[model samples]
Target: MTTPRLEGRIAVITGGASGIGQAVAQRFAEEGADILLTDLAPCDATVALVQGLGRKAHQMRMDATSEADCDRMVEMAVQVFGRIDVAVFSAGVKTLPEAPRPGVDPAKATQLVHMSVENFRKVIDVNVTGVMLGSRAVARQMLAQGTGGAIVNIASTAGRIPLAGGGSYCVSKAGVIMLTKVMALELAQTGIRVNAVGPGYTSTPMWDAPEDSDAYRRAMSITPMQRNGTPREQADACLYLACDESSFMTGQTLHPAGGQFTG
Candidate 1:
């Protein structure tokens, strides 16, 4: 029998309540890693899924934008599990709610020109700042433990390929990619690896358009695969980055983008 890739490892995953984050938690657990799942919402379902996989699981509600919350998540992971071998920063927002304003059409709010400053800032705060804070906290823990670990940031193809109206999301993901490179460079000698997974149009809550909707059709038309990627597919990319299989890799962004943007 093949041994589990993450046997006896401990992993911390943010945004684990649903979608890609939940899938990552499940995948890690199946590979024999104990998990601490943190998210803004409750993660009972995710914890249950991990437990069902016969791996230990814990859940904590976390606000990704708060520095204190980021530190608390790292601390909590250490408290629950002896040490963290992997940390996945997946907490992010595709967009933020906009306040009622004249001349602002809800449908076009995501456009760069129509996007409110507040909404853009919120997206940046949650997507870029949150990842930075989370990764920093986790890196500190790994340094203190004196055991090198892996950190995977969830990015998107939007970072590399601009979307018509996804200005905030694209910019934020681009920031994440650059941050991953910087982190990897700084932590290279420390035995810690920092990488990113830029998934294509995956089937997640963030892309919950009706199958027959024009939005869905347009998205699929651009994907060479002509189908949306599953959360598990994205999780697999993350798994490779987090495991020994990718020991030689750092400061890289894997794109499972269905040929959307070949890098």
Candidate 2:
């Protein structure tokens, strides 16, 4: 039998309630890692999936934007699992959840110039600042343990290839990529590795446009693969970066972008 890549490891995943984060939790568990899954939403289903894989799983509710919540989650992970070997910071937002202005098209609302300061700040706070806080807290724990750990931040192809109406999201993901590099450099000597996964047109709850919609069609046209990537596919990328398989890599991004960045 093939040995599990993450055997006996402990992984802490933010945004683990659904979508890419939940998928990462499941994948890690299947690789023999115990999981501490946290999200602003309930993580019961994700917990069940990990438990069904015969791996230990714990769930906690967290607001990634809050520094206290980020620190608390890391503390909880150490308390429950003893140590954290991997961390996937997947908590992020594309736009505000509130309905768009009555007369303005939703697409227009997302344009950089039209975007409200509140909306841009909210996305940055959750996507960029949240990753910073969580990574800081987890890195501290890893440093104290004196054992190396891996951090995988979820970025997006939009960070490199700007989306017409996704300015905030693009900016936030770009920030994440920079953050990953900076953290990796600072922690390289300490044996902690930091990397990013930039997925394009992934099929997740974050994507809700219909197949016939202009947004969906535009996404497909730009993706040479001409199909949305599954959460599992993206999770596989995260797995690579989190495992010893990527020991020589840090301060880099793995783009599972369906050829969106292809020349």
Candidate 3:
């Protein structure tokens, strides 16, 4: 029998309720890992998807920004799967920071001014701080278990861009990249690995199109691949971080940007 890539491993994936997170949950389950899926909202659908794959699965409503809640989720993962072999922090929130006042004309050039402090902070709280809390707690657990594991923090190309007043989301993702490096260093002694996946203009339902409800044709035209990526493509990248094929790798960012940066 072929050895499944993630056979017998245990994983905790946050933001598992939808989009990329849901994609990861499905991919991991197919790889033969028991999974604990968490999100701020009910995860019944995700839970069903995983279990339907004939894998052991558990779901819980999680508020990633809460320290206490994060602690509990980690605890639950250990109790459910005995040890966590992989952790993928995929929860994120996005909005154009100074998104011209609702209903404003898009053709008019709007000043990319500083967005409301409250709005900026809110994005940072969930995207950046949440990734930190999840990584920290899971690292502690993996260390105590005496078994090395992998961590995949989802980042974005926006992390490397100015993003106008959409600064909060971009900065938060950049912080995730740096945190992945620092944590890889801190956990090197424990044999655990850490990395990040940076995706650009993915075809997730978050961005809708007029015809097929996909990405704008204009955006796809710029990508070297001439198309946005599927959630599975990004999830496959996460799997590399979770699996042993990347055993020698750590503290890196895997760009699944479809060559958006090259040209």
Candidate 4:
């Protein structure tokens, strides 16, 4: 009999309420991993899904932007499963649309810069700072355990290429990419590998606008595949990074953007 890929492993996932996070929890559970799911929203549904798959599951409400929450999440995982073998940092905020103004030309819409400072900071707080906190907390625990582990961050194609009206989100994700490299380099000696996955126009609530919405149309235009990626596809990339198949890989960013762009 063949052994399951993640058998006996304990996985921690943030933003596990829905979309890519929920999909990852399911995929990891199917691979036989016990899961600790956390999100700003209730993650009970994802927990139930994992339990149904015959794996141990636990859910906790966590605000990814809070340092205390990030620390608590790691402690909870250890309390429940004794150790964390993999962690996927997927909690993030979507790019907010620029507000409509009277008499503004639609032709130069992309050139308009009306984004607020508060909005920019909020996105960074959750995406960049949140990942930093999660990685730090998990790395500390893994170092104590002295067992190699994996850290997978969820970046976006927007991080590779600047998109109009996506200034804050783009910058935040770019920060995540660089942070992954730095984390990988620092933790290499400790046996903890760090990597990132960049998904392009994924099918998630973040882009839940109507198909005819400008955002959706814009995403479709730049994607070479002419379609948004599925959450499961993004989850598959996470699974690969979390598993031992990519043992020799670290400080890398895997672009699952359907030929949209490579970097």
- Top-lDDT candidate index: 1
Q: Scored by CA lDDT, what does every candidate get? A: 0.93, 0.92, 0.84, 0.89
Please identify model 1 stretches exceeding 4 Å from their true place: 97-100, 104-107
Residue-wise C-alpha lDDT for candidate 4, range 59-125, written one tens digit per residue: 9899988989999999999998999999999999976544565766654333426665677888889
Instruction: Write candidate 3's Cα lDDT for 1-263 as tens digits.
Output: 77888999999999998888989989999999899999987788988998999999898888889989889999999887778989999988875434455655553322234356677677888888999998899999988998899999999887876554356778888988898999998887788999999887776766455534433665566578767788888999999889999999999998887897896
lDDT of 2 at 159: 82
Candidate 4 stretches with Cα past 4 Å from truth are 97-112
TM-score of each: 0.96, 0.96, 0.90, 0.93
How high is the lDDT of residue 111 in model 4?
40
Compose the digit string of candidate 2's lDDT tens values, residues 89-178. 999888664357787777577787777888889999999999999999999999999999999999998888877778888999999999
RMSD of each: 1.4, 1.5, 2.8, 2.2
Q: Candidate 1: lDDT of 1?
A: 100
Candidate 2 whole-model C-alpha lDDT, 0 to 1: 0.92
Where is model 2 more than 4 Å wrong at Cα? 97-107
Clashes of 1: 0
